[model samples]
Target: MESIYLPTSYRSSKNLETAGYFEKYSKMCPLTWGGSSSDNFCRILEEMALNDFSEVDLSALGASCSINKLQLPSEPDNFPIEVPARLSTKSKLDFYYPVTTEATQLNVIKCKEALEKKWIRSEFKFGSKRSLKLTITDNMSNHFRNDILPGTNFIYSILIYRPFSMSMGQKHSGEKLRFAMEIEALGTNLLSQIIDAIECVSNYGVLKEVENTKVNLKQFQNAKQEYPSQTVFIDGVFYNDTRSPDAEDYSEPVIKWAREKNIGKFTVSAMETTLLNTLTPRIGYPYVYIHQGNCEHILTFSDARLIQPNDCLVSEKYPRIVSVCRSTNVLCLICGIAPSQWLVKKCDRFPQEKVFLCTDCCNSYLYIDGKKVGDFELYPFFDEKVT
Candidate 1:
């Protein structure tokens, strides 16, 4: 794999007089590299050059030792200069994206190759070795989620879902095998680095924009244009439903309704989700799935609203939701899917209480309100009070 050469604003010296000892020096640096920001990393690296001892000689100092003291090792052999080994981060980037138009089979292969063997070496100014081995290595693999919705999978590689992700296109039901390109190195700005590398070696591009598609609820012939129990609005964007327009709703009746209508497919995109989450944050993130009827639904939070709902709470920052197992308060109790129709049953423990169940989990037997209940059988011990 050829290392993708990305244009970086910052570069470090590979030929400083102390270059030979950097490997040993890095081991002694006090800064935690993996978690530090790019600017902090560079600052720390500069500090190393200022006092080479800060990099190499301080290894003998215990964790409590002060860097200002700059203690030298009592035993020279303990700090014996060894061949410079390339330094890398213990973390690896797992690049997973649906195979969309912006990314093709050939593009995926090129990226895989670049990430597997290519090393992104740094360009040094004064060192005799112009190319310094930057923190990038070809360590990648392919994988799939233990559970993926059958229809178009709007797969994402983000650890924490970001709003910007919504602008990108999505995968259709036919698409499979999300490209999980793994790159390991000791540095930051990995996403930018990968984009640059792919651009250099291959035509594969990321974050490609597609023509926006308006959602049609008619496809889900059974569902009304009704909103969910909770309506949230942020920055002019709204989140109202759990499933796509044509897809099955979270409640059993709604799902059965859509199934009876013979709804075949549904599509949702990260772009749609980004629209909703850009302003509002929810406990559940956007996800894609294939339903029992083979219908595809792209879920952002639960569902999004193009038209503002009559009732909604507006906020500027991401709002947090406390974990509760109630359907009306959130989504489905079972899968967390958007609950269109809810099953109301008497709590086994508190006869006065009502328990809500989503469509899929309604008939499914499970423990509710501290007691076991049959599909459609109301538990006698469960409490209706959610909370």
Candidate 2:
């Protein structure tokens, strides 16, 4: 991906207003009026005129949850031309704005109301088909400040991914793909909400779940093409499903094609549509598990969610159950910093609740009584490993 270029001199009204808020707050007088709909911090940063502005490449952010460019092995027939970038408007707060309008003024008023009532946080949705959904936030924002804060008051944003498209092809077109973007503001103080919207966007945005309901699977299964049972050589490998009990059943061409190329690096026995994680079960839907990869993962459809956390432990109460993070708004018990994901260790002392340790805190060996006890290990459900 090419670097994003923005004007070096043009300051967005949002930034100017934020600077004004800080200025007025020092004198104990607060600004209570907002004029424009907010954009995500990423998009805001992209537009600002800064001499030393830099954007973090999503692809280089590593497998830690991010708004990454979606890549597929090969194009399948049912690929979505326009994905519904749904913006979730729910947050952990007392007030609620279940319905939102396209009007920017209404949203600004709604944000102000939430602040006046002492609401700590709120999320609003904005977007349509093929466009990125913006998760506009309203929160009493007291978070980290990077280089942009000193020069410009900017709204923070993060990329959110939800399972909406089924990728089957390896090659990608040169055209730039538009990802779902979410925006948030953190109110600095009681006045920040009225003056400058300083709501913070969560770095750990929600990844979409694949839509794999049983009804959808049945429809897909019934709609698949039937092929005669015969031995076929694909890529110099003998591809034969004739001996299987379900050999006569119709197969989706993508799965058959994947099998030919050994797409997921294993035998494709059964394609079951199931939720990826037990915790985030219904957030997204219909994830296609290619069955046995080198291992048995309930939601191993793509590389993003496939990689197991290095120090994660299995649930003693429920085997074969995988959870991405123990809690949604969890603070590292050892570090105090909020992480996108956590390395969860089962609490033998209290089996009901688990302990969350951030990667940095875990690396430092959070100590007690002269003993290092934060090292964690994975409880593998299967033996095979994939590169």
TM-scores for the candidates? 0.20, 0.19
Instruction: Kindly report the root-mean-square deviation of model 1 from the true structure over all alpha carbons.
Output: 24.8
**Cα deviation of 386, candidate 2, in Å:** 24
lDDT of 1 by residue, 143-200 (tens): 2222211111111122111111122355552443221122221111222221222111
lDDT of each: 0.30, 0.28
Off by over 4 Å in 1: 1-45, 48-50, 54-56, 62-232, 235-237, 240-277, 280-387
* Highest TM-score model number: 1
Query: Per-residue lDDT for 114 in model 1?
Result: 51
lDDT tens readout by residue for model 2, 112-212: 45452332222112212233222323222234222222212222221222223233564562233223223232222111121111111211121122211
Error of 1 at 49 (Å): 6.3
Whole-model lDDT, model 1: 0.30
Ten-residue region with minimum lDDT total, candidate 1: 199-208
